[model samples]
Target: MARIAFIMLCHKDAPGVIAQARRLTASGDFVSIHFDGNSDPADFAEIWSALSDNPSVTFANRRYRCGWGEWSLVAATLEAVRAAVAAFPNASHFYMLSGDCLPVKTAEYAHDFLDSNDCDYIEHNDFFASDWIKTGLKEERLIYRYWFNERTQPKLYYASLAIQQKLMLTREVPSDLQVMIGSQWWCLRRQTIEKVLAFCDSRRDVMRFFATTWIPDETFFQTIVPHVVPRNELRNRTLTYLIFTDYGMPVTFYNDQYDLLLRQDYIFARKISAEALELRERLGALWADEGSIFRPRTRGRGFSAS
Candidate 1:
């Protein structure tokens, strides 16, 4: 059975995605991809050639260019998910990710546990704004899509800090509306994925409504899952885990964290720059751990490496 499917989005992070997917496949998991509207076909071909295993790649339709809070980016992902469902009907869980996301551990450990839980990990209620991701107090802030300018705040380093500094200066978003912050990525159940897509397809009007909104991914998935599963059942956080500063600043875990990451506990991590040196070291670490930790765990049969 196709146990899990990773819905990965990449603009140019092909090399990183390739290394990550290979490890996942080695553990007997199937992988699927949707290169974003921006990746050139030739670049994609180079990516395809690098992968050791054969994985399905979907072409994402980019109806419009998206900025930090723009709904279009989320719209593109939804389209890809819709396509994945039509194509891989039998998969048990639908996992979402970015090309920049690298596994902290192996897929088997994460999938084995998730498959057993038979629960979804989406949050429904409005995320009360308290520097949501440290963006602001509540009043002046916009969904990251609005406030984050890739051109102006090109890297996450600048983007996250720039936004936070502004918040410290203002300390508020607005009193009018509620704002919630969450990872754009998630691990949704097949039923839930179908339900969310069905809601969007059934109510094209609602889809249109979200598209115009800022940072639609945060709202789109958060809104749809609540309709299918009770808000409480939706997990409030990603299960794979993370490392954050004492002040709750997220520090990118890299090859140095590779040993900990490949430990039998985690699924994935983010803000990984494929351009970084750690990719190779992390891949090497996974290769070393793969034999003992990843293999027997394939069918829920071995000791967890973490």
Candidate 2:
């Protein structure tokens, strides 16, 4: 069986995070958690107390005050990955997840699925090649520097963005590197993660440029992995299921969606609330019977690029 390391980025909802962690715990699978520095540690006291005795669980020592659209999120994730790698040397695959994320399948099913495939499961798309211009803020995100907090200084943010656009001070990504954007969640092989970390260490210029870019977490891994791994080695699909609202925020799952969620092939689902008692109970019951739901399914050796 393949040993898996789950790197979870959590901000709030202690009970929910603990429940998700418990569901994913197995003999050979390790969980590495990074709680946002901005969140009060008191909120997570129960979680730490519960998992402190579990040898399989490890917490990131270098935590970050992560902000939306900031590089801090990516930094925290890297810290979790580093801590996990150090703690679980035998881990074959590393999965990035959020506190709200819950396993839709059993731990045994997840291990078997990963063990059966060699390709990295990640979702990505070429930003310039796609109709990203339709999103309106694509140029602003790619060209101008958004170092300041948009929420605190909305006028200054827009003024700076406008000046950069009017002055045509648009910056180009490194000529050799292709810009890839995607969902933040992914599962990568141990070798792939090591290669990506090495690339980051050697390429300080690329890292510095992306530091001021909007939502760097969504692009950092997506951009670096393609350069390190061959196209045939990538699955180009995230195994987690998320429903987006018109405003682009992920919709929280409820008890009513239990049957619908179970019908999907995704191994996990996200953005569930800790207080959702009915949904939590239903999901718990489903997890107990996932062995029957996820019977061994055969496939070809490699994955095709999307």
Candidate 3:
């Protein structure tokens, strides 16, 4: 009886999120949602009312105005996870995902697979050793301080970087941290999450350092994970399927990409187009189909149906 708690960070598309929450809870999984503070009040109210009847659904109390590459994103995720943890004590795994993400596999399949495995499925690699980040300030993101939101204050953001570069003003990675980077989405064991949160609460210096770093959402938990979870217990992979362009933007699935979506064996996919109504409906039906088990075509990874 392994249960999962899904923590979703959503900013838009209330209908999509509401549909997803109902579908997720249909199989007895717990869903905790955190709507962005900047989202439309009407949409937020709509989602809240839509899922109010579901006992397995919970909403985070502390919402933050989230922005790209800002610490607010991580703050919002923390709020969601805290709500999920409080509501679902029996949840063995905790999955952090976006509002646009939807599962391609049944809840039974996800539980069956995770119950049999001991390692966490999170994508992570040493920041300096990997070339996954193609553009922007890669390694410099760790050592530099970013006080302004890149999306909202582009001039201040770049100007700050320029001043820091010119003055050689650099910061240090917390001595206890290794500075790992990875995809923001991950599926972590409950124990791992507990340890991560505990460490965060106890270490004020580490939190303060990451708060000013570039895109702390991508590196904060990633770097803390290695120090908490042992090497053998970490899978170094993600269950969510996502493809990034050469420019580092995630590829969005649309109505015409049905075949492309089905060909992948991942349980969930990221960045679905908001307008893909038919695609979502079709995928929703497929996900709720429990007659068949999900089998991964590629054995290269450790994922399996059994």
Best by TM-score: 3
Ordered by lDDT, highest first, the candidates read 3, 2, 1
lDDT of 2 by residue, 1-306 (tens): 888899999998887777767766744578999988888888668789988688888989888988888888889999999999888888899999998777677676777788888989887788778652335577467777887667667797788888887998888787888888888899999999999989989999898888888888878898899989998999877888776654565678776877666666677788666777788777765654644665324221122232
On TM-score, the stronger of 1 and 2 is 2
Task: lDDT winner between 1 and 2, please give it.
Answer: 2
Give the number of the best model, judged by lDDT. 3
Candidate 3's displacement at residue 119, Å, is 1.4
Encode model 3's per-residue lDDT on 1-306: one tens digit a residue: 678899999989888899888888888788999999998999999999998778899999898999899999988988899888888898888998798897767777777788888888877788889875768789788788988988889999999999999999988777767778888888999999999899989999998898888888888888888889998999887888877665556778899877666656677887788889888888777766776655556422222222
Give per-residue lDDT, candidate 1, residue 298: 21
Worst 10 residues of 3 by lDDT: 297-306
TM-score of 2: 0.90
| Tens digits of per-residue lDDT for model 1, 218-262 | 666765676667665677666434455545555564546555444
Model 1: lowest-lDDT 10 consecutive positions: 295-304
Residue 174 in model 2: shift from native, Å?
1.2
- Model 2 lDDT at residue 3: 81
Separate clash counts for every candidate: 16, 0, 0
The TM-score of candidate 1 is 0.70
